[model samples]
Target chain A: MELRRFTQPSATKPTHTTVSNSEIAKWNILDRPLTRSREELYLSTFSFLFAEAVQYLQTRVQQVSELEEKLNQLGYRVGQRALELLCFREKLNRREIRLVSILGFIRVQLWKFLFKKSADYLKKVTDREDEYYIEEEEPLVNRYISVPKDFGQLNCAAFMAGIIRGALDSAGFTASVSAHYIHREEKSRLAFTVTIFMIRLDESVMNRERKLAG
Target chain B: MSSSRASTWNKLGDAAYAKSEKVSADLVALTYGSFVREIIKDFEEPDQVNKELEKLGYNIGIRLIEDFLAKSGISNCSSFEESAEIISRVAFKMFLGIRATVSNWNSEHNSCSIIFDENPLAEYVELPPEYTHSLFYSNLLCGVIRGALEMVQIIVECEFVKDQLRGDDTNEINIRFKEMLQEQVPWNDEE
Candidate 1:
């Protein structure tokens, strides 16, 4: 397949016959196959790449929150693309309409795809109808990262939270997602931090859920 | 003899990669795409973005060489030629799950080109027309090779001579030998 290189002025529209065939491309990107899903790579490759991303973002921002926001935005891009590719690959014909199902889809399907395991916990806030949480004892992004004491309240899992928000927002479920770190200190056992992804659905989504249930 | 050695390295690469922990390639691709996009957004020029990406990869490479050494379990290479072969056949395979071809060697065997048709980092990427002329999308790989070689006492200048992202036939990283450092003991070594 060949795409003609256009050299004409922008003001006038040129036909294929008038345009010069200066360059030829061997393969069209659109013609590439999307069905093959067996692509796997070393975890260390990702870990190295991700660590560099964090360090690069660190130099670009001042505050921890700002750094996280940038990381989230980057992850958001990935999540948006991942959602479309995953849906197409899985051949999921039905769009997720309800709020809970979309959240479930993210917790089970997206989580499994990215992390190789379903999220450790998915729970609804007892007092709030629009709030939910997906907790991971150790997020894959945070595996090799140990937050220094000097840097406070910088959860690298903000990238994961952004991923959740991106997937949710693209699926037409508007929500605000944030990552919170919970330090677990067990007696006679080693201490570890858990990452909780807090997802808060929008009022419109709540109304739609209520209408669907009614 | 060299063919047998290449086959052994291929087998070693396969074994090491199979033994290591793995992740979905899509995640890596998306993350890399996002990282490059972020760099492009922050930097005004494509050349600047390319430099930043290379610096990022250099940092990663210096540290990753340690992991690569531990995983591959090979202590030494007899010559720079041997190192290039191991890099294309073993290191690329063990890390990225793809084996690149090393060719176009100089008569002195001090330089070579590593070529690969399939790039995992570029699986779902199509370079924007605006950035294709000046940007080397995979310049990070060049930095990685340079940094890793520096750690092994073989200082080499590496750069992307060809990139499929720029409508090239294949991705090729050209490496030129510069210097070799003398071995030294640690600063705190006891007499």
Candidate 2:
């Protein structure tokens, strides 16, 4: 696994690749795992801590729409982390191309990586082009929240949505996650529908990747 | 990229449990407390004991995502079935040192019987009746499952059948899935 094996110029290391430009990676010859520069699992642990921080911020946010935008930002950061891991975790042979294909990867591979199960099922709106959803009841991230009247528009789980949005956006898919009003339908039902806008690549980007894969 | 990556679709029941350490609900709660303080500053801590516990579980949901990823060999747990089983065996076992076996599953949702084979966290624990059947820290577990599954668009419901946080009783959880009710549809969609 050459770390440099990425086929896309876009996949090249972003400026945020690591906390410090100076710290270099060390390979563990014995285990053969890519040993991170630091001894701590701080990156992963802190990533979670940051998620909590995002939720904390949403508590006081009065407007749901404003809160959602903020959450999308928060999730964007987390999503970047997810994207890095997802791309690296893949064998690096060929990249996910078609909308359904990338989604399939997300459902099973990415979903498994994050949750333990892929979304319970997959449904697409035939009327909507390039709009797909991993419809779920009872979003795990939002389970404990009882949103108050003051924060009429905000759902703290929007923080998670932000992470998802960020992850998808970085991977070049223009996506946004929204938490729908889940009450009345079923109090126990918590659904987060992710709407991914198809990234209709400029013909050049598509042609380039196809050439690279070939 | 082993030859196995060829088949992206895998039945979760068939996947082998990842060989990793399990996590405990107690540990998850303790960690989530910080999450609450950090995330929801204005939100006063719930007075009701069960709600407080559920709050902690919510924090755990923020975390278990990363934990679930690392311990399960990162990529081996790829398919939905594989992911579900890994969450059941390795993720739960690594954290809780117990396994929740699937009791019933349908086209979408399923239930699992979580027998507390041994509970160090519950070594001398006791819960009042009000909290006995409560989901406790496991609410985040259900939430995480829901979120993770939703990433793939499978709307499902998960609830505890029993509580290990409580004493002397067998425990399990049920997750149900049903048809998506169109908001404007006047008729009952589930029936």
Q: What is the TM-score of chain B alone in each candidate?
A: 0.95, 0.52
TM-score of 2: 0.38
What interface RMSD do all candidates show, one decimal each? 4.2, 16.3
- Note the DockQ of each predicted structure: 0.36, 0.02
Model 1, stretches more than 4 Å misplaced? A1-25, A184-192, B186-188
Which residue pairs of candidate 1 clash?
none
What are the runs in model 2 whose C-alpha is more than 4 Å off? A1-55, A59-62, A90-92, A182-214, B1-191
Per-residue CA lDDT of candidate 2, range A1-214, in tens?
5765655577564666443211111111223232221111222233344455555555656656766776556555555655565566454566666556766766676555554456654557577554555544544455445567766645565554555556556666665555444433436765444323222324454555566568
- Residue A144, model 1: Cα distance from true site in angstroms: 0.5
Per-residue lDDT of model 1, residues A31-95, tens digit only: 56777444789999999999999999998888888989998998998889899988888888999
Query: Model 2's CAPRI class?
Result: incorrect
